[model samples]
Target: MTDLIPALRHLLTLAWQCDPRRLLRAAAMVAAGCLATPLIALCLKGLTTETLAGRGGSAVLLGLAAAALLVLELMMGHFAHLAYFELGDLGEVELQNRLVALAHGRPGLEDLDTPRFADTLALVRDDLPRTRASLEAALQLGGLAIQLGLTAVLLGLLDPWLLLLPLLGAVPVLAGNRAQRLLDTAKESAAPHQRLGRHLLDVATGHATAKEARLAGAAPFLLARHHREWQAGTRLLGRAHTRAAALRAGGQLCFALGYAAAIWLVVRQAQHGVSPLGDVILVITLAAQLSLQVGTAIQLLTVLQDAGRTAHRLDALKPLTPFHANKSDATSAPLVLTRGIRLEHVSFQYPGSTRRVLDDVTLDIPAGTALAVVGENGAGKSTLVKLLCGLYRPTGGRILVDGVDLAAADPADWQHRIATLFQDFARLELRLRDNTGIGDLDRIDDDAALSAALDAAEAAPVAAAVPGGLDGLIGRSYGDGVDLSGGQWQKLGLARALLRRDPLLLVLDEPASALDAAAEQTLFERFARLVADSRARTGAVSVLVSHRFSTVRMADLILVLEHGRLVQAGGHRELLDAGGLYAELYRLQARVYA
Candidate 1:
């Protein structure tokens, strides 16, 4: 009930922003149409009275008036639709844009990984289609309120007891609201299971997993798991819906009693000649219209409430976004890393978890230097990279880039000066050009830049092999699209990363993991040269993460992490000479290849 008014206001605001003229016209039409219902009933009563008195002229005039009111009701509603339809469409687009901004507009990426945020996002996405109807619902609810008022006044004129019908209508409205709340709770509870069910369905049906599922003979297992999740969610929602229906039925039953009593009272008055037959007709007509208005109001309330929840969910996400980390008067990042990056006792843990992913660790990375990080999986390598990229803030301590606090620097400015390639890079189903060009949106269409990036990543051959070269589509989801192999995709991702020219900090986190050993070595050599070129131009800093010792030894400094701790840090030869974790792991890998 509290959310209802705000929801209507939001719809009106959206409508006004889209087309104020249309909104005003729609409201006028809806009001006129709603008034016609009670007016038509009034004419029906007048026509009955004149017919009873055998006044042919007056009866015919009243009959024509009733017909005109009926036409007004139908025509006004139709005209309202004509005006509101475009407003609804435009409002839906505006809502979707707002949702998109809520999801990705923040500087930090914390909310993207949160389950609650994901649930809200899913719910809002499902609500998007109903945005069009929500506008109409808001208008209809206002018109219904007016219609109910007029009906109540007419009933009061008939008899004081008859006025109770409108009050009785409240029973169903309250019940409907309760039912909506119950269903809302059920839907929120079922979201996780529904999401899991959909994931399994995608896994079972997706082209990427089809071959593996066939070889593993896991189709039946996946189907059974999907069915379990789907059934779990379905059962919860089904029970809520059943209970809601029963509550509605009970309320309507209570209203039905009042409706019967009012009609009986009016009929009795006419039977005893205490009131005219025309008054009985009027009472019956108005009472039936009151019943219809109540039901329509319930349906409209349900639509409005659902949209209200979506708006509330969107509002809830605003605080979760990390905009507070950004300063209104932010300082610009350094154009070059003269003093390099320094991490002082930096530590991090995810939002709700206590277990630290990156424990208190201090390190310095000099400008124009190549630094390598090596560790087994789950050693906080990626978390460290994320912090460096300003995608996250440290739980303890701060990072300084060339003596400027990274946290205080403008996130957009810092991001613009850095480039990265992570292991699980995006496989965008776009044209080959866009797949690579998206790395630098400003230079997406720069052919010279594209060619250079392709050459640096050794992806020129891959692009040439495609039907339309860089313009060729990259996924089978679209028509006549070309699909690349795993290694080919990695090369394209590397090309995308390399497309960003003159980055102040270059990060390649296992960027060539999918390629063969020889290919990986070749790619690393090309990357080393690119790093050297950036360093020469702007004293850049580069961080490389890889398991291959052959690749790790190329770095000017190497840091070994174990269980979120910096266990060893030195040059390749110095670390080997120190004869600790680095030496042991290097020897073991050396033996495997020997």
Candidate 2:
């Protein structure tokens, strides 16, 4: 009882805060419905009593009242449904938008990577809206209570002992409540298996994995695994359903037997002249109504409780809302780096893990310098990029921009001064112009700037091939869109990054993964030239993360990393001249060409 009130309060507060007017209207309609439903029984009772007494004038009046009540019930039920639906529409959109914003604006990506947080996010996405609409269930529960009370009162007045019918109705109510509890528990337990089954089904059908699946002939394997998971989930749910069915049937049988016995007693009393025929008729009607209301109340209670629990989960996940008057950093405007970035004793380990991805790493990225980071897989290259871009805060030490602390600055404003093209960059599937312009949306419609960015990334020919050029859709999923080859998509990603005019820092992590050796060389050379030109004015710095030594040799400084430790850092010529790990790695890669 203690837990239920707070859970209900959480849902009620959510409903009232979002769209109070619609929620209030829905509540009023529920009350009207509750009042009208019970009055039907009363009007029927009056009509039956009058007719059995042979009172013609009273019978006609009572019959008219019953008809009026039937019309009221119909109208009330319709309006109640309408009001709740309207409220639901408003709440669903608002709550979903808030949940999305919370997940995205939570200040770090670490929480997003965890399984528990993933489950919370999934619930927010698929189920929170239904929880938002639970206000209707809550109000309906209120209506059910009122109906039960009215029916019980009327039955007692028919014969004082007839009040026992409401108590008898409790058996069915308890059974229904228990059944709902079991179902909810089974459903919750099955969620992980259900999710796995759905994921396996997607893997079997997804276009990205189609080639691999076909090559391995693993479609049958995937299907079998999917079926296995589905059975695991359904097995428990099936058991729960079977158990609940038996409980429901048993409770219903008891109610039916008790109802029959009550009717017999009422008829016997009327025959002996202890009670009027009207009294017998009233007892029969109210007895059935009491049972119906009890069952309805139980159903509504289950929904309200489920929604309340979902609401509580959502409340736990809500981020600290950003306010208009938030404390601004000293460098509120986009900062321009004069000296460069300095990483002092930086080390990072992901949440819930002990191993550091970057271990006590230190580096000086001077303004106007081109640096290349060369490392094998799992050498912490991506983690370094994330920390540099403020997607993560270092577990130890600090990143200083010239002299100011990067972590102390506003992440959004800091990020605006930087551009990156990751290996797994996003494929927006938007129009070519919108896709390119996403890097600097303020100039999205600026045709001259768009043309320059596209030309700089050497995507001019690609754009010209499309029928509508910048306005053409770029993916086949929608419209008359054209999907680009892997290499072509990499070039588009480059164009989007290059579109960020006057960026103080640029990081390209394996930006040419899909391109050929010759194409990769040409693209990196062009990028280097572009950086040199931009560096001449804005003191911009560029960092390239690559495995290819041919591309690595062009940078002013080549930083070699191994197993999360900096093994060497120097100019390419100096590194080659020295007989170190960098020299050995360069020689090994040079053998590939030989």
Candidate 3:
């Protein structure tokens, strides 16, 4: 109930902000509808009394009033529904916008990967589509409360003892709250399993995985796994719902007993000439309305409780503030790096893990140089690249760009001056132009810029051959779109990375994993030349991570990593002369080519 009031207020404020006139109209109609119910019952009682006294004119007038009240009760709700339905939709859009802003406004990537934050975000997303229904339920619940109170008052005026019926209805409201809590707990417990089930289903049916699934003949296995997860989630929820239904049923049964006792008391009073037929009629009508109102209120309260939980989840996520929130230094990133990037005893490990991915290591790269990082799988090459890109802060020590602490600089400003192309790059299902232009949104429509970037990535011919050239859609998901091979898509990703103008730091991690050996060699040669040119112009430092020794040799300097430590560092010829991890790995790869 404490959470309920705040949640209701939050939703009402959103609704009013969305459309104030509609909100006012809806409220007026709801109030009128609530008042009409008790008035209809009063009119019914008056009509019955007048007819019994043989007052024909007064009875006719009372009958007409009862008819009008009945119409008002029925039609006012419809009018309110009409007024608020669009308001509810607008409220939904407003809520979604807020959630999106919250998810994106944070400057650091920590909150995105944190497990508790992820779970809370998922819950909010799941509840987002229910915003409209929740608003309507809240409004309906208010109207029901008003109607229930008025019915109780009318009964009290007739006989004070009948007021106990409304008090009895409170039992169901309390039961409903308990039932909702149980259901909420069960739903939360089931969410992970449900998500897993959906993921398995997507893998089995997705376009990307279809060929693999067919060759492996794993359809039956995937289907069985999905079924297991689905059933596990449903079973937990089913038990909770059954228990909740029983609890609610017991409360309603108690109400039914009270209702029967109240009817008997009224009948006994009339039999002893202590009550009139008109009063008995009024009591029965109000009691029936009270029963319906209680049940509706219980149902509406359940919806409101679910929405309350969503609101609370959002509040819980408030502390996952932006990483640089309270930092005194809000320095802008350097326009040019004269001293290049320097890592001083930098170290890092993922959240909730004790095993360091990168140990205490130090290195320096001069400006206008191409530096290559080579290592075996799990050697922390990618983790090092992430640190250099300012995606993750070093756990120990610090990184400096142009002698200024990278940690103190604004993340957005740093990111704006850097560009990266990772192996698992995003395949945006958009046009060829958008695919490349997304790298520099400010110049997305600049034809000369797009053409130059495509040429730099050796993708110009591929784009020109397509039906619509730069405007051609790239994914089969769109009708009439052209589907590219794996290598072609990688070229587009490379083009996108090149589209970012004059970046001070350019990091490429296995950028040509999908291309052939000849194509890979050609791509690296072009990148080496581009890095040299970009460095001379903007003093950019380019970092390369590749398994191909042939490509690694193109860098001005190479750093060899073994188990997260820089075991060897020197030029290609220098490394071969100094026999170590790098020398041994180079020979093994040379044998494969030989």
Scored against the true structure, residue 402 in model 1 reaches a CA lDDT of: 92
lDDT tens per residue, model 1, 384-503? 988999988898999999998877888888988888899989999898889999999998889889888989899888889888877888988887788789999998899988998789
Runs in model 1 lying further than 4 Å from the true structure: 465-472
Predicted structure 1: clash tally: 0
Best by lDDT: 1
TM-score of predicted structure 2? 0.89
Question: Could you tell me which residue pairs clash in candidate 3?
Answer: none
CA shift at 76, candidate 2, in angstroms? 2.7
Ranking by TM-score: 1, 3, 2
What's the lDDT of the predicted structure labeled candidate 1?
A: 0.89
CA deviation > 4 Å runs, candidate 2: 1-18, 129-135, 159-189, 235-272, 319-334, 465-471
Per-residue alpha-carbon lDDT of model 3 for 1-594, expressed as tens digits?
655897798888888889988888888888898889888889888988999999999999999998898899789999998878888889888888888777765565656667767777788998988888888887888888788878888888878888899999999888888988899999888888887888899889999997799799998999999999999999999999999999999899999999998899898999999989898889888888888888988888888998899888877777554667655667888778888889999998887778888998898888987999998999999999988888888989999988888788888889888878998999987888899999989989998999999999989877986778888888878767888888988998899889998899898999989998787877888898879888889899999999988788878889998888888888999999999988899999999999
What TM-score does model 3 achieve against the real structure?
0.93
